[model samples]
Target chain A: MSDTTPAVEAGRLDTEALEQVLAAPAARFRHDYLEVRGLRVEFDGFVAVDGVDLTVTQGDLRFLIGPNGAGKTTVVDALTGLVAAAGSAQFGGVDLLGRPSHRIARSGVGRTFQTASVFDELTVLQNLDIAAGARRGPLTLLRRRRSVPPEVEAALETVGLAHVRDLPAGVLAHGQKQWLEIGMLLVQDARLLLLDEPVAGMSQAEREETGLLLQRIGEQRTVVVVEHDMEFLRAFASSVTVLHQGKVLAEGTVAQVQADPRVVEVYLGTGAHGRGSRTAATSTEVE
Target chain B: MSAARPGSARTAVARPDWWRREGVRLWGGIALAVVLLVGVAPAVLSDFRLNLLAKFLCLAMVAVGIGLAWGRGGMLVLGQGVFFGLGGYLMAMHMKLSDAGPGGVPDFMLLYGDGVVPGWWEPLRSPVVTVLAILLLPAGLAAVLGLAVFRRRVRGAYFAILSQALAAAFAILLVGQQKVTGGTNGLNGFRSFFGYDLADPVNKRMLYYIAAGVLVVMVVVVRLLMRSRYGELLVAVRDQENRVRFLGYDPAVVKVVAYAVAAAFAAVGGALFAPVAGIISPADVGVVPSIALLVGVAIGGRATLLGPVLGSIAVSWAETSLSEQFPSFWTYFQGALFIGVVAFLPNGLASLGGALRRRRARGSAVPEVGPASDVRPAAGSAGGVPADPPAGAPDVTTDTVDTAGRHA
Candidate 1:
């Protein structure tokens, strides 16, 4: 956008970077994982996603930024195997398209819900214990006790939730619930963490802590955060993909995208809160 | 215990220590249950009534299972009677065969016009085979059913309807198979239990002890399950299934195992019920009876460890007394009791004492103040931690806020 690239001027995709990245993504990446190609999701006769391709290198925190109804969550839902999707979604070298949600999660691709979804009745320790896959079998129920994994302990300590480890999760506030969910994904040893609006309901200070938390998590796992918070994305997202109407509207640095005349006029209206996802699911009509 | 924070903090503070208080309470409850079961029942009840209580104890075994499945796992298993009936019939067939001696058909088969024993019944003529069938047959059925339903992700009311339909179908099938199962009248009038003559009052008392022991074991097993990590996972599945799945747990496997255990318990109950009740019929293993098992649990508190057992016995006792007093209308009275309990005591009778205690303690608990911050950001540290206080913050009021707060 800043360079006056002809493809942006012409109102069509400049597929050079997307194609190059998808084709030989392994050569350019540290972790070099998560290649999605021509992924399409449909419901009834409507196409929610129409021929979208993405390649995420491991350990890079890529922010998937888009307006409301841009099929950002649908993308995560597809990768998480909650929807009937066509085309390839691969984690490392393994296909993720047809696997169940639990299998995909167990296979190192962890996802949090649009709303904070933690087990409300379970204690913080119990919640993390399940994510760590500790003593889960029926016969294993006979075992007197299992020691807490060191990693789980570290996660609770890191999230600042070690004190409330014994209290039921339902007692936690909104921000704490979000942090707890992320902690759950961390304990799952998720290689790729897909977080949807990780800071949606948090206050300014909590958002900062969460942003710092996400940045720290990004250092370890490949995190693809689907958020409408452009300011938060601008603060931490090193590379960004701008989605509009179920396609990659733009892809580059936040400054580059903000500078693009087409992007300024066509998307990112009224800053971050304009393109919200509260009505994102039903209001969007498929092409 | 605060209306602001609904955990067991205020009570914990009042006690000597958290674990000791909880440990004492748990052990006290267990000791009291054992005393009442072992000491008081035999001394108080007549032989006829004690036998009835033993039958109810077997019913309570199934209720204990229902507490785990329907209560903890959020699986509404209305077809437990399928397993219960199968075990009862298997045990009955074995006992009848044992009574008939070597290489002989049961008197019912001969007198009821089927002069030869069926091939299926022949294998069950062996007591060992019968015991194994009682243990494994119901489990196998439940495993298959649980796998099919849960793997397909069928849950909630659909699951309830499916289980009830199976129970109905099983009862119909049993009713149609008159020669083998003894049809509507059911298999009864057993002469012996493991060669102990049924006529002997001492052996009858032994049967009561057996029922009592088995129920105690089932309660303890269920208590262990509820306290275990897997038990917590089952409750988690019941609450937020998709969340559990995303946490890399197969909610289906968790559900299936709980269902199978529930089935096994019900089957065990049925096996014991045959020896104690001296009968098993379509009337006792149909949709009505299956739902009847749930009534006590619902009244008692399905989620609590002792609630289901205590509630089952209490309901059975009430039914006995009320029926003697008003034979025709006792069922309606029982129905009213169930409705009232469900409406008023949703958490059941087990929580009643806790609720009363909390109400009384509400006024006295303004005594303490600890700062609302733990090094763990205390919600206040983060400056945006929203509504409840941070984890270690002491709650002063022992107000009545439900532990299971409603979620969307």
Candidate 2:
């Protein structure tokens, strides 16, 4: 009976400790807001996302950097509920397993896809209006009854797109469209935002602006950003998680992760010729 | 959800609110036109023309359904003919049975060598049963079909194909069931509707007025539905289905409701069509005729409120007049017209007025506002940012670079 009592006490103590850990603010160096345990995604026996564990804590702008077939997007898909996932994904004590993407969205997680999904025909204001979830009924008969709240305008302003609000979303610049998408995420009031390659093809200036925008957005919310650009990661992300062959090879500050032998072996090994040139260019730019 | 931030305030823009001010004016104009045409035509036109107009009104009822389901909901419902056929067949059967006298088979059935009416047709002999069936049957079928298809998440081209196939199958089934359904000939040759003598000119005119009144009521009902929350959800589902789902709306259920309403409207139209047209045949309930109905809607601009009704009437009128004048080449001419409209005017004839108005306004030297370039600097940045590349530029390569940079 004494032995059983200690075991029960130990179980209770462990649960209390777990709860405390979940509730406690994440370390400044680690921004993991959500943690996945043994996530296994299969497509007819082809294991696209094999038993993988990932942690995305708050305040940590961690990069899920990997090669082409490394399942970074699949991990994002699983987290967003776009793809069915196996095992538990614990976020703020809620188990995000077997829930629909919309339910997941309502549960304080917002996501942007690799491709833009804005309505092409609708105006920029209309796009934002639709995303705002203000219009309640089918037709716009009562739409005029309730005016567009100031908050919606602020979101568009935040994205630096106030001037062309009346223009169709289709006419906006590519960078502006991405920003508009981010604005949509902002309107959703999600605690966590998942960005999939937000800066894939912008100019250096655009990329810098994006980096600044991400850093600003990250101050108020947890942002999980995936990218292939090491320079951008170094500039924006506080921490980095290197993925190779569907598993985390290393996770630390940009310099620390860059120095890790395994990360170098996997990321830099195949591109031996361009490594020195790129490194020199990066060092010169920093200086 | 985070606390509401004050930074999210939007600047109000001053634009001519067309959907509000101009929309009312346009609707008012339409109302005036209806008053002048429908209200005054009865006083001026012959009874025969008035009755023909009433039949057209019945067809307009079917158009209302097409507009709601296909235009707004984006459901390409080619099986509306099935509902229309159900209503017409039910009404025709009732009228035929009423004219046959108690315990007697209909005149056509007796002449066609049917000694006894089929058991399936027996229930329709009662006006109550027939009327109930007319309304309930089409809606019931639509509900069942909608449930099956929508539950499976079948949409787009697959949904269109499935609905068109249903129309074809319905027509074939009716044609095959000669003894029970009157086969390819269909139920027709009614002598009376609800104890009114069909031979009397006054009665025919009365039927026309009834159809016109019913059409007006249907339009009002559809307008109400379009203005309701359900209508907003329907359009939302059409535009951003995933987003609507995320907003906690089951788009399937919304689509089904819209589809069922459309089926009910079609059924009512079919019921009136039987009495007014004096015939309901396989030709009216088949795939070709179903496509013809859709053509009218597409020609008029399916999404526009009055497009379907006006388009259907116009097309029907053209077919009647052209066939009277040039029967052999009228079908070819109609096909050419449809092709030209689809190819050249994708938005349809309803948009023509808007386009013409815009052109005329432009011709009168109305200065158009160049694109606005007064974007405020991004929050936390005092420096004005340069204009970025347009989002939906044809150049995919540029987008790839922008996306890469933004994510990086």
Candidate with top TM-score is 1
Error of 1 at A286 (Å): 19
Q: In candidate 2 chain B, what residue range of length 10 has the lowest lDDT sum?
A: B4-13
Instruction: List iRMS for all predictions.
Output: 1.8, 4.3
Clash statistics: count for each candidate: 0, 45
lDDT of 2 by residue, B1-408 (tens): 012211211110243323235566557645865685568878987987777777777878888899999888989887788888888888988888888877778876776646688778789778888878888888888888898898677999999889889899989998887776778888888899989999899888888778877777777677767655456557767877766554434567778888988898889999999989899988888888888888888888788777888888888888887888888877898798889888877767887766554444343222223332321222112223345443212122222332332232
Positional deviation of residue A133's Cα in model 2 after best superposition, in angstroms: 3.7
Q: Can you give the DockQ of every candidate in the order shown?
A: 0.45, 0.13
Where model 1 places Cα greater than 4 Å from the true spot, the runs are A1-32, A134-141, A144-146, A272-287, B1-23, B365-408
Comparing to the true complex, what docking class would candidate 2 get?
Answer: incorrect
* Cα lDDT tens digits for candidate 1, B31-147: 877798879999999999899999999999999999999899999888888888988888888888888888877787877756888888899877788888888889888998899
lDDT of 1 by residue, A73-128 (tens): 99999999889899999987878998988888877888888788888878889888
